[model samples]
Structure formats: C-alpha cells, structure tokens
Target: MSKNSTLILEVKNLAKKFGDYVAVDGISFDIKESEILGFLGPNGAGKSTTINCILGLIKPEVGTIRIFGKDLFKKRSEIMQEVNYCSAESNLPWSLTVNECLRAYSALYAVKNASTKIDELLERFEIAEFKNKRMRNLSFGQRARASLCKALLNDPKLLLLDEPMASMDPDVVDRGIKLLLKIQKETGMSVLYTSHNMWEIEQVASKVVFVNHGKVMAQGTALELTRQEVQLEAKEPDLREVFIQLSRKAPEMEEK
Candidate 1:
C-alpha cells in the first residue's frame, strides 16, 4: 500500500467460532493511519472476538487480517513489532515495581533507549511518584496508565485499546485522552478502540463500526450514524438511540 492510501489495518470476512457458536460472523473493516476507529457494540456482540482475531491471538475460522499489507498471521513478528494492545482486564505482575514492569515490557518489545522512554512516560502520565511502588499497591487508574505506557513502549504504528478509559477518574481520563491524541499526532499511529461509553466515543472516534449479532449493522462517522437515525424518523435520534434501535430486544418507550 502506498503511504497516501492511509489504510493501516484491514480485516476481510473475518469469522471466529467455538464449536457450534459463532462469535464473529465474517465481519470486515479497515482502519487508516492517524485515524481513531471506534468499535461499538452491546455485550457479547463480538467486539472482543473481532479484536482478538485482528491481533492473531485466536485463530479465526475464516478471513484475513492484514497490517500494512502483510498477512498478520504469516508475518506475526513483523506485524507485532509495529502493533500493541491495551485492555482493561490485562494485568501486570503483582510483585514487580511499576518501573520494573515497564522495563520488562520495553525489553520484550526491544525498545531502544528503554529507560528514557519509561521515564518520559512516567512523567507524562503523572505516575513518576509511583514508579517504585509495587503493582499490587497501585490503584486501578494507575494500573490503567501503566498498561497504556507499556503498550506505547515501542512506539507502535497501530494501537488497539479496549476501554482505555475504564477505571480512570475524570481528571485522569481527561489527561489520558489528551495524551492519546498527542501520541497519535506525533507518531501517526492508527488506533482501533472499543468502548461502551457513547459520550467518550463521540469525543474521540473519527469513524465507527456498529456490530450486532456478529455482523456489522452500520458503519460510518459518528455524526453520519446519528443523522441516519434521524432521517429514519426514529425518536430522539442519537448514537445511543441508534444503538438501541438496532440492538435493543424490545421497543424503548420514549419518556414524555
């Protein structure tokens, strides 16, 4: 792909299955460089399964995942060197100090000038004071910051974030969002982020993919999706409204 093409991550007909259950039913999408793509869906709507397929963490029953025009599974090492992920449930070693964990991740990613990068991230996230604190001693917000720092340790070209703002205070979430925007601007990294918070997604995502029943029900800019709903004469058309219209099991009664 040419630099001007902008496509950074591409998924074509991706599907995943566990015995008789299909988690992702041949979903496809692409994320472009310097773009923050939001993956939105209800619980068990295959968001996580799709992410796992993109990361090559689980083998999909069908379809292809390409990073920078290279097959993700065939070129795992090359793909991984330029990609990273952060998720809410991912844990740090409880016995390791914050600094140590960062260093360990830096080593794993073979980041040059690892110590300098770790120090810079520590200061950037305002966690320098807790650098020597054990992982078990850090609050949930602090751990989230640390996870983000680790994900960016190698300065990846593609960053996958699953609820990056979870467990963060309002102040911390503000800081984190700013830091994420700054990083994307500086490094030109493409981000594929999943979130349940419609407000947060509206704030950060340039485009969105809405999934339901293991398939993409809608894909467009957030504003486009909202407007589409309004054109359909749906009551109080908004992202949440569209989400409910598409995925809600029962018709939601509009409050008087």
Candidate 2:
C-alpha cells in the first residue's frame, strides 16, 4: 500500500502503570492499511502492554487509541468486529479439537461459510491433519498455528500478532509468513506484528517500530534503521545486530 493509505490504527502518547511501576510510558505509533508494522522491543519494553491497550483488553492510564478513524474507547464493540489478535501466550480450550475450537470461533465471529474458511485456514497452516486432534495433544508449534487460524477466521481488517511464529520450524515459519503476505495483499489487511525474530520481521514488515522502556526509541524501514549509525552499531547493519545493539544500549536509558 502507498504511504498515503488510510491509517488503520493510531495510538498516541499511551501510558500505563501498575502501582509503583510503569509498564507503558508515552508510547506512540500507527499502522496504515495493508501495512505490516513490526513492533520490536526487549522482554520488558512493554510491547505486549501496548498491544493490550490497542485491543481494548487493558485500559491505558493516559492517551488515545483510534482504529479505522474511530475512537477505540467509545466504539470498542463495533471496532472489535474488525480487529483480531493472536499470540503465543494465548490458549484455546485444552480439551477441544482444533476443528471444534475453530468452529466455535467462527460462530462467535459470525463468519459465513465457516466450514470452508476453517478448512482453508487449516490447509494454509498445514495443520489439517491435526484438526481433529485435541489442543492438549498438539505440539506447541501446531497449537500456535491453530491459534493463528482462529485469528483469521473473521478476516479482521486489523490483526495483532505477538510472537506467532515463536516455536515453529523454519519451513513452517516461512510458509506462514508467505501466507500472511498473500492474505494481506489480497485483502488490504493491516497487521501489528511483534516478534523477536528480526529476520522474520525483515522479511514481512515494511516498517519497524523499536520500543524500549515503554517509549518509542526509533522507527523506520529495516534498511533505514540499520543504516542509521547512531541508532545501530552493527558492522554489517543487519536487523539481528540492530536488535542486539538496541536491547543492550536502550535499557540503560530506561533507568534514567
């Protein structure tokens, strides 16, 4: 999509706290239509906290969130219909089969032709063989793929994914990335993808946002961020090197 594409999501100066500790501090970012914005941060940099605020699952103490140009707080119910989230930490019913879990979500999302959609997602994730397998019986990678299928059941206009490929084998991860790219191209869907896999982000994201200590430390295309000598000290200017440098260097600022 063009840089002029409509903004699918906008978060401005978001902040959140847990009593004595700050979880999110003055974070801001936006996602444009059909764009994949990769959110990069260290373990405690509040990436997940920011995502929760965007999903309306957690209220921020300060700041505004808008999705599709509408106030997320005021139009949460309506806005959520067009948004979906998937994460490695999320879980489906342990006793239910993959097919059963997906069928239930399709109904919840009020998806039409649910059967066909479910089958297609299963095939896309290469998990059709495990459709009838119970969630507890599947491996971590398999379960993660199943959760991803659930996220797409509604064909959400905005998708939030956190470490969705964390445990997948390289081959499956590649296929999953390709499938997401294909879907995004065909549907103009926007994705807020958070992952530690710098290589994966470099492959799929057009823009990357780096956050440390709940603040946006930097953002740009992968090449731009890597090329910035002050922002990254990588000899080769690679994304993985950039991540390591930022994590080490940015954390010191968190305490100041």
Candidate 3:
C-alpha cells in the first residue's frame, strides 16, 4: 500500500498475443508486499490475459514476471509454495465435498496438520454446516467461500483472486472482506484482486490499475484517480466516474 513498501510482484513489459490479436500490450505494474491491488477493466479489456500471464497459466510473447524479486518461470516450484490463486469460474470436482476439496488442495500445497487447518477455515468461513456437501450441490456463495478457504490453506505470501465475493449475500460479503483485510494486516500477504465491482474494489484495494484495450489506462489509489477531476470541478468524484472516463477512451483520446 505504501509507496515505500517492498515490491513482491513485478510484471514488466508483459504482452500476450492470441494469433493476430494482441490480448495484452506491454503492460507493466508492481504489487507491494501487504498491498491490495485492484485490477479492474471492462469485459474483453485484457484483464484476463494479463492475469493468466501472472499466474503462469499462459506465457506471454514479451516481458518477465518476477515474484519475491526472483524470476517466476525459473523459480516456479519454489515460489508457488508462497502463492495461491482462486476464482469463481474455476470449479472443484463435483464429487468432492467441501471438506474433500480442502483436503485435496492442502495436500497439493503439502500443508502439515491439514485436517486441523481445514477445520479452522470451515469455521472461519461459516461454512462448517456444509463441510460435507458436494461441490456440485453447494450454492454459489457457498462455493465462493470454499474457494477462499482453499486459497488460505498454505498461508501464502501472495493471493490472487478473481471475483472473490461473486454471488455472495451482503452479510457474507462483509465478513469475507473483513477477513481479507485482516489477513493482509496480520500476515503481510500481497493480494491481486480482480473485480468488476468498482465499489468493492475501492473498499478493499490500497491502489488500483485500470486497463483498456490491451493497455494500462491508469494506476493509482482511488483518490489519486479522481484527483484531477476533483481539483477542476471543486467536488469529490468517486472511482466509478474515473473508471468510466478512462475505460471508454481511444488511445488518441487518452493522449488529449
């Protein structure tokens, strides 16, 4: 969050191309230790492609990804022990119960005392009642919580989430947000949070990056994004206003 904080992740000159289409165009950013970085963009705005590159799910034609100041591709085995990813779109096996899913992931991360950790997460997420429920049968909110629980199993140094509170009720959303903030404060874990919800992003992220048409439109805190407008109009502007203004522009328009 602080400009002086240690950089935990760096994406330098990252570019991903899908045949002739350039999905990501030489984007670069840094996530500081214990910082919550909100990655926001319109649909088809290259957010997914950039995230895929960061997670090592896809290789970019250009640029390097460094985690903990080490090359991610070269040190993947060692670095991944401290990194975990979660998304509402990725599903666990339908046959696996909530407990089973947690158990499976814990084993993957080689967590010790996994059963005890799973119990603690189940209670923390308030999903203990559904711990034995199959993934296929769980409601969207239930599955979302389960995914988050799994991400925490390793006590990772970095957590990557896409639409983390998707389909959650108000109460659950509040609790989940609180828990994320608590984890950031206590463990000093860095977070890369992608969400379509600007309000949610403002509530959680210390800084945000907005991408449009395969390039970075803006990167700064909510206040900084709206600062110019507020200064010009002598009124406060919310992040959504700035987001829309930036995301809808042509590159030439941006120059002007």
Give the winner by lDDT. 2
Ranking by TM-score: 2, 3, 1
**Candidate 1 on 162-193: residue-level lDDT in tens?**
98778889888887888888888888888998
- Kindly provide the TM-score of model 3 when superposed on the true structure, using C-alpha atoms: 0.94
- What's model 2's TM-score? 0.94
Worst 10 residues of 3 by lDDT: 228-237
Q: What would the per-residue lDDT of candidate 2 be over residues 40-133, giving only the tens digit for each residue?
A: 9999899999999998989999999999999999999999988999998757999999999999999888999999999999998889999899
Ranking by lDDT: 2, 3, 1
Please, what are the lDDT tens digits per residue for candidate 3 over residues 165-205? 87888888888899889877888899999887777887899
Poorest stretch of ten by lDDT in candidate 1: 247-256
- Distance from true position, residue 58, model 3, in Å? 0.7
- The RMSD of every model to the true structure, in order and in angstroms, is 5.1, 2.2, 2.4
lDDT for 45 in candidate 2 is 92
Residue 90, candidate 2: alpha-carbon lDDT: 53
